[model samples]
Target: MEYGQPQASTGGSVVRAILSLLPDWVEWTVLSLIAAWLVSLGAVQVWRRIQYCRAVRAGRPIHAAAQYGQGRGADCLGSYAPPRRPDADGD
Candidate 1:
């Protein structure tokens, strides 16, 4: 009966209500699955970094974008090629 004010609950509340109806084990299982998935993704990234470093150290030609090295300024293990200027190649 209040004007310019919504009275119905949002979808988030409905989702929470449904989730509350689930068993504790179900919540734990979902949380564990999410954690495992995130950890696996991180592992894959670490592996890729290792391969990239090895390639750089071995003097192999890497087909990476010029901007890729700038973002990896410090966190990079050994070293990477510095990012090129946008107009350096006259692109």
Candidate 2:
């Protein structure tokens, strides 16, 4: 009736015996490969999310205050200034 001892059942005894015979290196390698794959997937998902945010922010309208046709001359009407560069210095 020890807490850590295997139960007296056929399947449990088989599982316990197999676990005792497994090599430590085999277990470690399997666990490491699984962990590496999960980390790589997470990095790819984060990169995709960043790209999506950039695309959405790029497509947003520039200004609410300025008239659609304000700056350009009579023939050149209805165009706003080009989208500002995110990385620009205030020049």
> What overall lDDT goes with each candidate model?
0.75, 0.70
Misplaced by over 4 Å in model 1 are 1-15, 64-91
lDDT of 1 by residue, 1-91 (tens): 9899866678868867777888999977887998999999999999999999998999986656545335544335445656557776422
For 3-77, candidate 2 gives per-residue lDDT tens digits of 997668998788667756779887677669989999999999999788778777999544434565443233244
lDDT of 2: 0.70
Candidate 1 displacement at residue 59 in angstroms: 1.3
State which candidate has the highest lDDT: 1
Range of the 10 consecutive residues with the lowest summed lDDT in candidate 2: 69-78
- Misplaced by over 4 Å in model 2 are 1-21, 60-91
Task: Tell me each candidate's TM-score.
Answer: 0.49, 0.42
Backbone clash pairs for candidate 2 read none
Residue 5's lDDT in candidate 1: 82
